[model samples]
Target: MKDNAKISSAVIKRLPRYRRYLSDLQKKNVDRISSNELSNLIGYTASQIRQDLNNFGGFGQQGYGYNIQSLYNEISSILGLDKDYKMVIVGTGNLGQAIANYTHYYKSGFMVSAMFDVNPKLIGLRINDIEVLDYERLEEFMQDNSVDIGIVCTNKDSAQEVVDKLCAGGVRGIWNFAPTDLQLPEGVALENVHLSDSLHSLAYYINRNSQMKDQD
Candidate 1:
């Protein structure tokens, strides 16, 4: 077993990509994979893969390569996906509803166990078979359901308040969609997804490609 806290954040970030690629290889009946093969498949250098694996102790054979199932299990356990994570969504707006309905999230190890909203009309509504409970009942719901993660899709102004309530209610992880900076307490993990930043970057790439074509 490895200490997840001790692992570099960069390595931790790449674990999900590695897991997905390995899963694809398994589906293709790949029994063994070399670091070079993984590197090519994932677009990472061979040496980087070896170094990442070395951090968790070498699992690959000297010449034979790594067993697909063994490597998958090792990575899965390291990333804490071996066990299912129960999550709740805070906010029942368009983005929140879409996230609740996203089938791919369920295919992974995360489960959207519940949803919360401040709107009285939206409360008690069902989205994708998950009941939308009142945000006022967040503490009770969290205690009753033992939610491990929270998806914050509230407006920028209320996002911090919602996070504060979530923290007080015992959430360890938060997937935030608000475009505001959040001040999180210690031991709580906050992952922000900035839609505006992504769109801006996409526009930059489009312009860059156009300039490249003009040069050609």
Candidate 2:
């Protein structure tokens, strides 16, 4: 792999999509693929694919293209999907429960070890066999368990506080579903999944396409 710091975020973001397509190809028993062939399937230009991949040591050969399974495995390793991550979810609300269920079904290395919530009704409730513990016990749980990631499903008001506690407790990363942005101390990674922003972007494209159709 090349120097990670020098790689553009755009290239990094495209890695997962590349891996997904490669996975699909592998399921179909594809042994290798040329850049042009992969670009047709993934919608990226062949040159773009080659350039983006070149940032990560150029997995493709000049004429042999790329080994399908090898590239898939390499990209997965690059994205850190090869390792296991034990996570704790803060806030056992509807979204939190949905995430817990989704993670339970996902056959990946990510596992939700525990969940926390402030609601009395939700506390002690089990989702996918993972019990929701009281928020007050979060600190104690953190001290006792080795958590690799923290999932913030709380409201904007409580998100930062939950993140602070998670960071203090030594979680290496945070997957924030909160509507607001959060600050993190150096060395702790953060990935924000703002559903509203995505919905708004969808709305924009929908309206834009409708207007274009009307113009015709």
Candidate 3:
């Protein structure tokens, strides 16, 4: 650990992109890649890649560049993917069920062992081959199963309560998909997924490009 306490959030945020791109390269049989090559593939400048990787000790060689598999493993280890993580979803709605069905997360070392819902119909149902449990048992389930991450797919109204219960049950990470902001404790890692915000940015860029074209 290279004193991650000092690493900027922006740098930390790019690790997943690096891992995903490296996996893509591996699938294409790319063995080694220089920073400039990687930059072209991922749209990040070579200097940006160097700086981001340098935060955790760069893996690039002086002239040999980087070995794709080795670099992927390095980034995976940094992202805590070397160890299997048990996950539980707090809601079994469409969003929650979609997340449960997302198999790529499993390939990335996260296992969705269980799901929860308050609706009587959703409870006891199986999604993605995992049995849905009653939300009432969430706290006990967490205590017994050693959940590493809690995926909060609840509505915005219930998001905080879900997070509180999950954290209280010893979950160290929360991937919140609700449409609101949340506050986490000192050591807990929080990844807030605001879907509409990205769409809003897309619309803004489209409008801006249209205006630029009008001027041209």
Candidate 4:
């Protein structure tokens, strides 16, 4: 096992991308891949890919490059994707619902164990076969369940508060969907996803292309 303290978070994040590409290569029966090939597929420079991979240890040879199967197993184990992770989601809104309906999580080694909300009407309802529990029961539920991660889909105004509660409830990792930047205490891992920002960027690109066509 690699020392968690020694590995940089940036390298940890890139491990997933590496795993996905390696998995794709595995499906195609690709026996080996060079760092340059990985760089081209993932949009990183060849030197950058080599540096990231070398940080963990030299997995590739000087001329033969990396064995696809060996690299896939290595990255998967490093990222903790070799084992199943228990996860829960807070908030039962549209975004939360969409996530609940997503089947890809199971395929990726994460299982959504529970869903939560403060709404009386939503509590006890089922989303993707997981019962929607009242937020008041969060702490108790965490005690009974082996939840390793929490996903926060609450609004921006309530995001920080929800995160605080989750932390207090013993959640060490969080996937925050709310727009607000959260201040977390030490030993907690928080990943923020800004959907609106991605949409805005997409819109900007489309508008820029349209304007260029109009000029031409």
lDDT values for all models:
0.87, 0.95, 0.90, 0.86
Q: Pick the candidate with the highest TM-score.
A: 2
| TM-score list, all predictions | 0.92, 0.98, 0.94, 0.87
lDDT of 2 by residue, 1-216 (tens): 679989989999999999999999999999999999998999999999999988878798888999999999989998999999999999889999999999989869899999999999999999988899999999999999999999999999999999999999999999999999999999999999999999999999999999999999
- Best candidate according to lDDT: 2
Clashing pairs in 3: none
For model 1, the stretches where C-alpha displacement exceeds 4 angstroms are 1-3, 103-105
Which of candidates 1 and 3 reaches a greater TM-score? 3
Model 3 lDDT tens row, 45-145: 99999988988886999899999999999988888889998889998889888888884355767889889999999998988678899999998898888
Model 3: worst 10 consecutive residues (lDDT sum): 101-110
User: How far off is model 1, as Cα RMSD?
Assistant: 1.9
Candidate 4 colliding pairs: none
Better of 3 and 4 by lDDT: 3
| lDDT tens readout by residue for model 4, 8-69 | 88888888888889889999999998988888899989898888888777899999989999
lDDT of 4 at 56: 74
